[model samples]
Target chain A: MNVFVIGIGLIGGSMVKDLRSLYDDIKIFGLDVNKAHAEKALSLGLIDAQTDYDELKKADVVIVSIPVDVQLEVLPKVLDHIDDDTVVMDVGSTKLKVCNVVKDHPKRRNFLATHPIAGTEFSGPEAAINGLFKGKTNIICEVEKTAFKLQEKALKIFADLGMRIRYMDPVAHDKHIAYVSHLSHISSFMLGKTVIEKEKNERDIFDMAGSGFESTVRLAKSSPAMWTPIFKQNKENVIETLEEYIMNLEHFKQLMIDDNFEKIFEEMQDTNHIKEILNGIIVNA
Target chain B: MNVFVIGIGLIGGSMVKDLRSLYDDIKIFGLDVNKAHAEKALSLGLIDAQTDYDELKKADVVIVSIPVDVQLEVLPKVLDHIDDDTVVMDVGSTKLKVCNVVKDHPKRRNFLATHPIAGTEFSGPEAAINGLFKGKTNIICEVEKTAFKLQEKALKIFADLGMRIRYMDPVAHDKHIAYVSHLSHISSFMLGKTVIEKEKNERDIFDMAGSGFESTVRLAKSSPAMWTPIFKQNKENVIETLEEYIMNLEHFKQLMIDDNFEKIFEEMQDTNHIKEILNGIIVNA
Candidate 1:
């Protein structure tokens, strides 16, 4: 099988790594707008060879793993160049915009929109892991729109990589993900900004940061190039999540101002149920 | 040497776990306002026996690891019972208030104000782990106010547990800690509250939450009984940090409203420096 992975960064590179170990006959090709990243992917053995759009015609699978904004511009071109039977899939964070963009495309049936809920604070090809998707949920958006055979092919690959799949409409995926994923990155980044601004002496933060601070601010290190586009495409939903988040923060502050620690204790006690909910998740790091 | 642990919870229990392994002749006793916790600690071998304040005079060292509010009430009383040579140390999150509470006490010279910057989300005797303080920072405040021999006694224990000692004034310790430690807890708890309120269908959150959400919200699982008092005692600094955090969130929300994704990108890029700074410290999960 011929696998063409475009924009070979963390997600794309990780998929190909899993594919290489899963199948001996598979030949993987990678492409990146950044020449350095593609070269790094090549030297890192993440891909068999670097290829161009023209070679996509022979590809059995084309994985679009770039920033969501770029996915808008590049995905259609990728569809135009791929073979009739080629199964194209995108691993972008936001699904609604990408799904809407290819809704009426000539080869819409060949494209499968998937959001694999997995990642670390690092990025680029070097950040790829061997089993990045193992036991992680992969939300498949508008699966019925894709060709049945292509869905089967992708499902087989996901199964082989030990991924669990859930089907959802692109709109719901974006809305719910705004709460679970997008909002987390924003909250983390903002927390980092607030602390960095307050602690002029970096030594203080270094000396005082505990596991709680490290865990809470971990996502602040995420790639801006990747997350900025996600927030842009899912603006409405992201804004809603942020508004509610800001309101909760403001309300909590008011409770502090009112010296209503009894209420504060109850609020945190209620939220502590999150522990049980989170127990179901398998965090990579 | 006889060591008395005033509250046999995560911090005090873990300390005795280390002390038990670090010395053969030292006898450890524990007391808790909650009878069951002291019994559980004794059963778990975190303490050699359960004892009350009547045994404090026999205490060569007294470690107070209760909530900050409770510490204000109990620390002076604990001082009243301990011998002049008995070095009393606290592992509370907020230092200034605790320091002030015992500032003019007759046994002030025997007390060492210390905040061990280490913990997991879980609490209670069961949450105690051996080597919990290994390579973590332990902030010692008002060190000069502590008798030199008492400081040596506390410092020896810290060294034996492989903890790095940092001397900070109580004012600076509380202020700096509000930004790095207390603020992270608020951000995380509010993040959990926001997501829980939005995703009424908890299944959606369970399915969608990735490593990012899990990391950012991990602290939300912390015991409310432990945190509410810390916030109450450190109200001013905690409120200041919250104001700055809320302002940053509002500013980021404005950036999203204006479609100023470029600025959003830059903001995250600058905050990415946290990763480098965090590398200097060890976080035991």
Candidate 2:
């Protein structure tokens, strides 16, 4: 009944909260490269104790909750240190590289590749709060590769956390994620950059930024340390999605330049279907 | 005192809520080209009464809250009907065109061109709520042209609504708003379009759209009826900003294709400053 969470940031710390709430007998341990985050998680009562690499062997379950590049670095090590009965899982943004990194490991059957699609723009342990995963989707890739017993344990945990699980191939998961998630970060980050570069008046930006600007640029606040590797690992799919996204912007911009207000209106009216689609995405409190 | 609110959409109806709370013995009249919206405003108590074109003359002050295209069509007429003592202010997204259209009118001094940087993605009377402008910025343009006495009354109204006012020239207002407001809608509308075109699985879009995608594309839900005229009125500025935005995206895409991870990371890190900037923009509850 022991769970050791590696790199305890927003996702890891939030997961630890839900796990403890679900199982009274479970003891949770956390390890973070960020000493400040580790201390904060402890002060926030997010973990039972701070464990190290040496004590990582004592856990029945190990969750790799770090950036993708770091996950590629430490996941094999975690699998090597754990016992045969231990269940190892990772919640990384990009899955293809991580899945391939451990594809030939002897203990790969005990490993699970998952991405729980939830988080705010903020990062680190202080950003963690209860119910981050509630009613969110958890994408499990190559679930068939995992041992049946360990998969059952992970599924039970997600169910207890109030999540709906969707199974997909690792490649498909990364591609769709590039379109739905990574492109948004890039679009948002660049939007912030373009406006910042032109609008020299900082006070004016602050004064005139409506909720729409706030929402559009919110992801620009995401952690650079976390995102750099994600963009690197999923480079091809990310590039393809970026091209399509840029082309769409260019097309819309051309319409604006042509003073084709009617066409622009029609295109935007077509895109308004996202309202109906997003309603299913956002669960109200 | 009397205040006549034309259009009766999100901005107009929300303003009515605040005016009632901030003023005593002030009668508010609502008008809309759409009968259903006018009726909805009345039922929601957003307006004291549904006013007609004939009744617009009885106002001591008038708020011409409508779409920009309609503002161009009807603003002069509203000015023609109001007395010299009445202050006719507009809450349109664009300023230059509206300011230009009425520049030579005999009652020009009676009209004040203002753009309040406030609103949610949803529109119409039902979308109206209390305190939409509280702690938000209100941009008053061409103040020199507005009568000194009338400017005093308008300033008092903005202050009573818990807004901090910033004044700029009409041309400057449209240019800055093109970058800070209208450009955001274009970015968001296209982002939604790009992602929607790629992911045919509506259920997948529903499941995969995290708060990041939701935040980035939130403006896609905005009413086309309202935004069409905004782009048309601010055509040159919107086109300029849109071109810059598209170029930024193209540059980012090239870096991604070149696998220039370091440059991409640095760019995102720089834009991360927006997080700090946005804190000043959003007023927390």
List-wise, what DockQ does each model earn? 0.79, 0.77
Residues A19-65 of candidate 2 have per-residue lDDT tens digits of: 88889999989998889988888888888889888886788899899
* Candidate 1 residue-wise lDDT, A104-171, digit = tens: 99999999999999888889999999999999999999999999999999999999988889899999
Q: After aligning candidate 1 to the native by TM-score, how far in Å is the CA of A39 from where it should be? A: 1.1
For candidate 1, the chain B TM-score comes to 0.97
- Taking all chains together, the TM-score of candidate 1 against the true structure is 0.98
Q: Output the lDDT of residue B137, model 2.
A: 86
Q: Estimate each model's TM-score.
A: 0.98, 0.97
Pairs that clash in candidate 2 = none
Q: How well is candidate 1 docked (DockQ)?
A: 0.79
Ten residues in a row with the worst lDDT in model 1 chain B? B276-285
Tens-place lDDT per residue, model 1, B1-285, is 899998999999999999999999989999998998988998899998988888899999999999888889899999999888899999999888888989899999999999999999999999999999998999999899999999999999999999999999988888899999999999999999999998888888889998899999999999999999999988999999999999999999999999999999999999999888788654421
